[model samples]
Target: MAATLRNLKIKTSTCKRIVKELHSYEKEVERESAKTADMKAKGADPYDLKQQENVLAESRMMIPDCHKRLEAALTDLKGTLVEIEEELNQKEGPEFEEAQKVITEVEQVLQSTEA
Candidate 1:
C-alpha cells in the first residue's frame, strides 16, 4: 500500500512537471507568433515570411505535442491513484480513502481540461 501511494505521488509530480512545461511551450509559441507579426510590420521580404511561416508551423506542432504529453501523464497519474484507492479499500483502514477522494477530484479536473 505504501509503495502504491509512493508511485502515485511520483506520477502526480511528473504530471505537474509536464503541465508546467506545456504552459512554457505555449508561451514560447505565442512569443514567436508575435515576433513574426512584428517582422511582417517591419517589411520583411517574401523569403523571410516563408521562413517565419515554417517556424510557426513547427511551433504549432510542438504545442499539441506538449498538450498530449501532459494529458497522458495526467491519465497515468490518475490510474495509479485509482489503483492505490482500490488497494486501500480492500484493506479497509486509515486515511487512504480520504486521500483517494481528493485525488479523484483532481483527476476529474484534469480529464475535463483534456476534453
Candidate 2:
C-alpha cells in the first residue's frame, strides 16, 4: 500500500511538471511567433527575418517535444491510477481528487493537440 501511494504521488508529480512544461513551451512559441509576424509587418531586413523565423522554429519544435513528454507522463499517471484505483477508492481524499483532476486536464490538452 505504501509503495502504491508513493508511486501515485510520483506519477502525479510527473504529470503536473510536464503539464507546466508544456504550457511554458506553448507560450514561448506563441510569443516568438508574434514577434516573427511583427517583424515581417515592419519590413525587417531579410537576414534578421530569417533569424527570427529560425528562433520561432526552435520554439515550435520544443512544443511538439513537450507534447510527447506530456503524453508519456499522462500515460504513466493513468497506468498508476488504474493499478491503485481500488486502494485509492477506500482512501479517497485531496490527493486522489487532485490526480483525477490532472488526468482530466491532460486529456483535454491531448485532444486539443491532436486536432
Candidate 3:
C-alpha cells in the first residue's frame, strides 16, 4: 500500500510536469505562429519564412507525443487509485481527501488536453 501510494505520487508529479511542458510548448507555438504571420505580412524573404515555418512544424510535432505521455501517466494514476480504493474507503480522513483532490486534478487536466 505504501509503495502504491508512493508510485501514485510520483506519477502525479510527472503528469503535472508534463502538463506544464504542454502549456509552455503551446505558448511557444502561438508565438512562432504570430511571428510567421507578421513576417509574411512584411513580405519577408522566402528563406526566413521557411526557417520560421520549420520551427513551428517541429513544435507541432512534439505536442502529440507530450499528450500521449500525459495520458499514459494519468492512466497509471487511475489504475493505482482503483487498486487502493478499498483501502481508502476503510480509512477516511485527510489522506482520502487528498487522493480525491489528486483524482479531480488529473481529470480536469485530461479534459483540457483533450479539448
Candidate 4:
C-alpha cells in the first residue's frame, strides 16, 4: 500500500536523524576523554594547576606595581619616622625613643616579609 510505504519512509528518516545525533554525541565524548587523558599524562592537576598558573601570571604582572607601592610607602614611612625621632632626640623625651623602637621593628618586619 502507498500509505504503508509513506509511513516506512517517515520512520526511516527519523531513525537516520537519531543515528546522526548519537554519532555526534559519541564523537564529543571521545574528544573530551582524549583531552582528559592527555592532561592526566602531563601530570597536570587541573584544579589548582591551571588556576595557580593564572594567579601566578597575574601576580607576576602585579609585582612591579606592588613593589613600587611598597617602596614608596617604606620610603615615606622611613623619612617621617626619622624626622620624628630627630625631633624627639633633640627634646630627649621617652615618647620619641619608644616611637622610634616601634617603627624600627615594624620596618624590619616589613622588609623581611617583602624579601
Top TM-score: which candidate number?
A: 2
Candidate number with the higher lDDT (1 or 3): 3
- Residues forming the 10-long window of minimal summed lDDT in candidate 1: 90-99
Q: Estimate each model's TM-score.
A: 0.73, 0.88, 0.82, 0.35
lDDT of 3 by residue, 56-108 (tens): 99988888888888788878767766776766553344544565676687678
- TM-score order, best first, reads 2, 3, 1, 4
For model 1, residues 1-115, the per-residue Cα lDDT tens digits are 6777667667766766766676676677898899899889999998998899888888778766776776677677667766765767643333345445545654664565465
Off by over 4 Å in 1: 90-115
- Candidate 3 at 11: error in angstroms? 1.0
Candidate 4 residues 35-99, lDDT tens each? 55666678887794565455445544544444454445445444554554464444234443543
Residue-wise C-alpha lDDT for candidate 2, range 1-115, written one tens digit per residue: 7788778888898888888888888898899989999999999999999999999999888888888889999898888887787655644766678789999999998788776
Name model 2 segments beyond 4 Å from true: 86-91
Clashing pairs in 3: none
Which has the better TM-score: candidate 1, or candidate 2? 2
Model 4 lDDT-worst window of ten? 4-13
Question: Where is model 3 more than 4 Å wrong at Cα?
Answer: 87-99
For lDDT, candidate 3 versus 4, the one ahead is: 3
Provide the global lDDT of candidate 2 against the true structure: 0.85
